[model samples]
Target: MHSRHMSIVIPDTTADAVYAFAADPDNLPQWAAGLASGVRRVGDTLVVDSPMGEVTVRFEPTNRYGILDHDVTLPDGTVVANPLRVLAHPEGAEVIFTVRQRDMTDEQFEADCAAVERDLAALAAAVTV
Candidate 1:
């Protein structure tokens, strides 16, 4: 029910390259520090070792466009849909993430937004490096 969005721009990179990297769930840990660790594939599932515990991440099927939407299933079985996208920009590329402010306190929501910013920064650094 909570709807918010955060984004970052990656310089000197094409949307194609950015999507190529960001679209892969296995590359999440390198950028998403909140996950606490990298993801590994178990059959068709991508599992992440998060601070809250193991979480399952399911990404949309691959496409030429820069859509990187995914679903995160928490340990408690709550599924959070994360709408993410990469778009071509004259400056290079832009990565956007939607932050849903579910039942959390205002402070918690702020922290979540901050975490998304951090993750986007990490992603920019990883791709630009």
Candidate 2:
């Protein structure tokens, strides 16, 4: 199990307003830059579509937080589980995306962190400006 933490600050933005986008799966590509789409329900799993490949993603939201679980299958038939959390921050929001990979290395985890960071920035920009 590998864990990484990421945060994005949205100036003059409320948590709920930001969450409306974060909570919606259809809006993922808007921020993630990957043309990703998902269902917003607990059991509704979203799939990110790309020419390289496709990934099945799911998100679970609580009264105070949200969790996104993604399973990406490589063209070679290898699959990975990436679970992320979105929590309320004092000033903005926090997203903790975790990955449990048996065949990957720490460097891969770092790359995943970078991906999440991009998403965070997108999330902030979507609501602030």
Candidate 3:
């Protein structure tokens, strides 16, 4: 299993507000650019137009706590678990995403981490804007 974790601090946002936005799979493409270019709902599932191909995404049920876990199913049927969270912080709120190395090389994993950082920054800018 891939083992890496990353987080970002979004100023002037509450955990509840962040969770409300991030927990929704429809908002993913707006923030997680590496995941998909766009997302649309089809009945109970979300279809994403990803660079890898069309993928399916399923998010966990909403809860009071800021747990935004989801699963992404690739065209080849590989399911990747994405564990995300928004937690209350002294300044504002912190969004955390688990970054798994998967089968990528070190350089690839570094690039993936960079992508996650960019995504988180986009999320920060989006919510703040």
Candidate 4:
């Protein structure tokens, strides 16, 4: 399995604020900045349309933290697992978003990671200030 980790620190945000920002996908464009449009939910999953492509992110949240299982569906009908995590840090927050690229090109994987990193930065911005 292929994996990548990405994280960002929020300067002055509370845990609740950080969690709220990261948990809501609808608030993505407002904060995430990269997503110019569409995001919807099915059960616990969030489907987003990004400049890179369409990716459906699924999550399971407990009392302590949440785990995101993503699936990026290509225009040609290919799909892959996108694993990630959103943890509430004592001082800020940390997110690790990974994509498996068994059949994907190197560029696609890098773009996806970049998208996630941008999203994480925006999330931190929204929560902190």
Candidate 5:
């Protein structure tokens, strides 16, 4: 169960602001490339059009602690929990995403890491104070 923590600091943005923006499912497609195709709400469920097919995404309830954790249910019924956070930083806000190497090859894990980096970059660009 190896994991890699990747982060990006959003300059001039408060942790609260970043959390508020990123925590919303509506903003996922704008920043999260994996969900770039978009997401739809079907009776309280968030269904994302992913490369792997239609997956369900359930996020943690909104909180002041900056937790943006979510569970992604794949088409095959496998649930993958992704832990993410927006922390207060001197520069502004720092967003961290943990990439777990669950049942993945080294190459797959590396690609996942790179994808997370791009997502964080997109998040940094999308979040504004």
Candidate 6:
């Protein structure tokens, strides 16, 4: 599988603030528009209504390390791992998202990457506001 790292620096924002917002599944729909439409707690998992279908998202336990890694289970029972991080930057905080090309064509991968870019931009806007 091939992977691409997409990132954006939110000027004047703290890593803690960025992490706090990004770590919450409920806030995903606000920034990650391409990934989630709505989210609700379902026992131990976060049930998400996505464009693909209803999926389950499992995030790593909250920590001070700025790790927002998560596993997304598709409706077909396929699990896709997403690695995300918020790091302290000179200006503010940098958010990085890893997009993987598991079994997609080059065009599909490019589209996926573009979507991630847009999402990261949205994240920066939301966190900085």
What TM-score does candidate 3 reach? 0.91
How high a TM-score does candidate 4 get? 0.67
Better of 2 and 6 by lDDT: 6
How do the residues 58-123 of candidate 6 rate in per-residue lDDT, one tens digit apiece? 999999999999999999999999999999999999999999999999999999999999999999
Off by over 4 Å in 4: 31-35, 41-48, 52-57, 61-63
RMSD of each: 1.2, 3.8, 1.5, 3.3, 1.3, 0.9
Candidate 3 residue-wise lDDT, 1-129, digit = tens? 566788988888898888888877767777988665668888767888888899988887788888888888999999988898899999899999998988889999899889888999888887888
Candidate 2 global CA lDDT score: 0.62
Lowest lDDT 10-mer window, candidate 4? Answer: 57-66
Per-residue alpha-carbon lDDT of candidate 5 for residues 9-84, written as tens digits (9 for 90 to 100): 9989799999988987889997999877758887666999998999998888888899989999999999999999
Among the numbered candidates, top lDDT falls to: 5
lDDT of each: 0.88, 0.62, 0.85, 0.64, 0.91, 0.90
Pairs of residues clashing in candidate 1: 2-101
Q: Which one wins on TM-score?
A: 6
Count steric clashes of candidate 2: 0
> What 10-residue stretch in candidate 1 is worst by lDDT?
35-44
- Root mean square deviation (Cα) for candidate 6: 0.9
Candidate 5: residue 59 Cα off by (Å): 0.3
Off by over 4 Å in 3: none
The TM-score, computed over Cα atoms with residue i paired to residue i, of candidate 5 is: 0.95
What's model 3's overall lDDT?
0.85
lDDT of 1: 0.88
Candidate order by TM-score, decreasing, is 6, 5, 1, 3, 2, 4
Give the alpha carbon lDDT tens digit for every residue of 1-129 in model 1: 667889888999999999999877767778988675857897767889998899998888888888888889999999988899999998999999999889888889999999999999999999988
lDDT of 2 by residue, 42-109 (tens): 35655566544665554554445555555655555566666756566777665565544465588876
